[model samples]
Target: MDVLDFDLSDREFWAKPMVERRDAFDRLRARDTPAFFAEPVVDFAPQGPGYYALVKHADILEASRNPEVFSSGSGGATNIIDMPGEFAEYFGSMINMDDPRHARLRRIVSRAFTPKMIKQFEADVNTAAAKIVDDLLDAGPGCDFVAQVAARLPLKIICDMMGIAERDYQFVYDRSNVILGGFDPEYTGGDVSQVVPRLLNAGAELQQLVQDLASYRAEHPTNDLTSSLVNANIDGERLTLQELGSFFILLVVAGNETTRNAISYGLRLLTNNPDQRALWLEDIEGRAPGAVEEIVRLGSPVNFMRRKVTRDFEMNGHLYREEEKVVMFYWAANRDRSVFEDPDRFDITRSPNPHVGFGGPGPHFCLGAHLARREITVMFRELLRRVPGIEGGKPDRLYSSFINGIKRLECTF
Candidate 1:
């Protein structure tokens, strides 16, 4: 792991305007950092405390690996929900917790999302994906792919895993969008007083849904992931309600939002790079594993994963004390030239690509990584096969600093 400069303190460094802060993050997609180190260091501290943004791949990996120093408790992940009150304690998910505790919770749910479980999803995911693409084909020519396809695929996966009815999908999806929309827009839709009440409500509904499914599974077992979660064992104790709820939070945020953004944005990347799309179409192997990797490398759905410094620590030659926060800008880091040969050019086949689009490099890596890839891969495979010459339409960004991707991508088939 290494470090790179991205000081956000200087006003001149950021060309983006404050008014457009809520707009689609054009700043990131519009350009890449120049030359070896990428862009100049950005100073993110505004009107309050100061923290560094790791722009280069080396620095982001450095911050991600040394979780002890760059702890999440100090504000490792940027959030508007945790500014004060009970929101901080209540809204903290696996992503925001440090090693020991994060390890415990993650370990329990980790078994359910393993490679085997994801493989089971392949048939179902492919089926659902084919249906989505089929629907798009019937609709034809002009369609809002984000709403009709990208958003639906991930939501359906989460609901299917939890055994929730299709009717209730909107509640979880809508709340999740607001819950994760800190930088994009003020969460005016949901209650802003705290995240606990909202979380508890969602949890209660999910628990009931799972319990019903558990009863069904007991009498009539299936190959679905829910059966696995219900049967999970942690030190011989079955998962508590709190742990189960946390799993739901991760599923909705990570499984649904992240994958949706990746697919939608991945298409945007392809549309912009017709040559690359042509390569994928023309190639005998057909982009193999590289298409998804390259797309994710460029369209990083998870903008930044934050953590606070626990004890005094040093990064990229800068020193900081405990309680100080730092942001690992995965979006910026994945395009770092030091790591990728041609960072900005979206080649369909870029090997040895070790990008951190899955949140971090080490153990605390995204639990839903396999599910996300399956979701994106299935969608793209069906999309390219069914709809010919399709391209992205007027894209509407959700405008969030965390949990980013396309909210609405108009498309012409």
Candidate 2:
């Protein structure tokens, strides 16, 4: 078979059609190759030792399940090339740590998402969904669904959770888009250095905001999650100011971005497959749960996550050396033919849909996963109820290999 370029970080490669990319992954999986070399420098990082692309479902599952072997804490979870010391720690959040540290951080964060907390958030979620649908109705006929509808619910829910003022919603949203979509022309364009400065600046701005709020929360706590995070402690295990700032950034980006993209793609997927749309509309409440999973499977919002090999290990007849990077292609794994029969087909009623859209089976599986599903379900249910005829047009996608984001998508009812 001809060589397939597994350099997922390449912007041009990401810009290619989705079908072409999936076809390339299919060829790689068919080879039964344990891993393939990835370019060290793709977007803007300095040259370094390359990583391996983990394409198959089984391999990704193995890697994710064995976090000690394929460690996310060793270098950084975000990229194949290890970021600088402070930056890596800040961006990684709990995602980049192992053992006691990871366990401790997760416990503190989990406190914020306890059954009581989630139950309370449900009322807020419903209100947000209603407001979004109402605003879409006011706008009438057509609008940029990504901005007007898909983006609003998650952004509002997260901001409200943090007790942020309504006035600063756009400010937080803009910075998040910049941080996640810096490569896209709409957010940042030109040289790599230019992009880096903007990215750092965005991170700094968010840090300042979170730091200020956290300080206030410490003095006078509230019922919101920001206060919980600020005052969160478990047996003297508490997040330091820097850790709090980083976790805030993760919440803004991951909390808002993942669900936003999923909702955006849900509309697009349903638009493309009217039969499924009808299938959903026929019994909106009944189909929503499974339909949400199918949309997540197809969208695969966080395209891939990177892990570092701490020690040499063998898997699927290939040996991974110590300190080497192994990138789990979650997007590719979600479509594994072995995992999902006729994986390309958009079947809303896909039973046993074990897609790793929320990362593979691991300790680091997305914490906001339950919240995300509720947001998607509530928002789509609102859409089907209020604006059943809404149809999504072509998407203007984000120019990033990491996030499968929709920068803008027009929808008409």
The best candidate by lDDT is 2
Tens digits of lDDT, candidate 2, 1-413: 65766556567888888888898888878885654565556445566677888889999999999999998887778766777665753576888888778888888888766556677799889998999899998998668999999999999999999899899899999999988984677777666657777887888888888889999999999888778878876788778888888888899999899999999999999899999999999999999999999999999999888898989999888999998888999999999999899999999999999999999987988988888999999999999998998999999888888899999899999
Look at candidate 1 and tell me the lDDT of residue 236. Answer: 75
| Runs off by more than 4 Å, candidate 2 | 42-45
Q: Give me the displacement of residue 285 in model 1, in angstroms.
A: 5.3
What's the CA RMSD for each of the models?
Answer: 6.1, 1.6
Residue pairs that clash (backbone atoms under 3 angstroms), model 2: none
TM-score of each: 0.81, 0.96
What ranges in model 1 sit over 4 Å off? Answer: 1-48, 74-85, 88-90, 183-227
Model 1, residue 18: distance off in Å is: 14
